[model samples]
Target: MIDLSSCLSESAIQISDRTSCSKNSNVSCMISPNSTPSTQNTVTCLYRTILSTRKKILITVTWSKNSLSQGLSITIGEDPSISFKVNTNPRLFRKLKGSKSLEFQGCKVEVFWDFSSARYRSVHEPEPDDGYYIFITFDSELGMFLGDKARETLQKQEKSGPRMAKFSLITRHEHFSGNSHYQTRAKFCETGAAHDILIRRSGELEGRKNSELSVSIDKKTVIRVRSLQWNFRGNQTIFLDGLLVDLMWNVHDWFCNPDSGHGVFMFRTRSGRDSRLWMEEKILHKDEKEEFSLMIFAACKNM
Candidate 1:
């Protein structure tokens, strides 16, 4: 079991009347699998519900002199996270502004980036990950800011690969603990060819849960399948044992299966065009050796 009861140990300003987890039993959270907030919110309602001793966040709420909007409440923690209680949205949110503070939940919360932590990859490439980050709460109800990268990356692919050949991974759900079910031979974390940056959006997806392993290789050329690309629509599932799972991540996944290794899965691409699936691995579900057959275009091309 991944334990993460220590990340939020330090508190800048303490909330005196805060309820204790030793007494209550409802506010428990853990560090996600990737150990970064960007991976996944491992701390879920179920985690709280299952814990013997519920964990609760102790916070300070001081109303500031200058207030912008009455409806929004930003909770700033000295740990670089500023939680918000905007009257608009309620899913989960954080933004990309430099160090600053924001008001939330009827109190003035300070904002700053926590650079003490180790360096990790940022899902939104192009955006430099030179330093650490601060957590900010946003109105998920109003709109979202985290998803812009995925959309932008999708648009830049044509300049990266050949036509009717390349496509990108879009994460819809990101949670760990389901892939192991289907992949009895292997665990779920080793499903696709994505970086750890994904944990933030999908919470450390375990078993291809979120089809959002989005990529940004935008050169119009050939992309070897270094990873398994999971199709989100229906039963179009890819597996190691499920399909050419070993072929893609063989450099890493080969430790387990040596003899039956997959060659490579390549795709062609052009920007703003549909992507096709190309397979070169000897061990595959079917055969597509021919040039035209090697090109698997999208079912619906973008007009």
Candidate 2:
């Protein structure tokens, strides 16, 4: 395992403080080797927002794929202990469009989706780049909406239009497979720009005392760690969109199992004094403080 003791030292770095909220349970997307051959693509995002009724809630959206079909699920509530979820399985009915409705905390919530003409960049991506729309309405008002067809879909809806999304995408987790490089896109914070993040490692440094690890944002190289073998775990602060962000990573597995091991990375906003306590306590999850956190897991396979 990679040693993080030195990297986490207070003198070596200053971690931002974050406030804690409801605890979020781990949602696994791991594939079993004994299972039949099938494509496993999963992505999850957590949003913190207030409903039309002025009630705070956490919304989780998950997109996944298997050999036989693709599916999506939406969960809403203040916390996991009291949440409601809707699962849509397109493969079962062979339909690419559908809707569902339910009542939560006296509010009528409706979900609408149309993926008939969805387009994707690759098989590994569970989300469509275009030709899709997902709308979530609270009491006939739009609470959350996604995709490029939002305008067209809204024009066809009832007189009551959807409200602006009050929620902030606080956290996102994605799993992908690659050899030397892993790439993904994310918004560092609710109001920040969506950036393309790329993490690259070199094979030539496998047996050397130190390896090279480079991180890039929107194609611009931001930080590069040399002799990673000696420093596989650490944290650094970088400025993006005029906001300071704390970048943390642990890549010990890369050297331990070059072919199958996975690495973890996180991007979070810098907070005040309390943030230090959270770091010491290791409370790195969704919280009421609006301290947005994103974690990425990259699975590296042999090239």
Candidate 2 lDDT at 132 equals 84
Measured by C-alpha RMSD in angstroms, how accurate is candidate 2?
A: 9.0
Model 2 clashing residue pairs (backbone): 17-275, 18-275, 21-287, 142-162, 142-163
Winner by lDDT: 2
Error of 1 at 197 (Å): 12
The ten-residue window of minimal lDDT in model 2 covers: 19-28
Candidate 2 wrongly placed segments (more than 4 Å): 1-7, 14-40, 66-68, 78-93, 151-165, 189-192, 204-210, 257-261, 271-290
Give a tens-digit lDDT track for model 2, residues 1-303. 124323564544542222211011121223234432212257888766666567666678888765555677788764464343333343455667778887778878787888877787666567777888988877876678778787677777657655655766767777666455666777765566777776777545467665788777665555667888887788765666555566778887777876777777777665544343134124334354536666777765632
lDDT of 2: 0.64
Error of 2 at 191 (Å): 5.0
The residue-level lDDT of candidate 2 at 183 comes to 69
TM-score of 2: 0.73
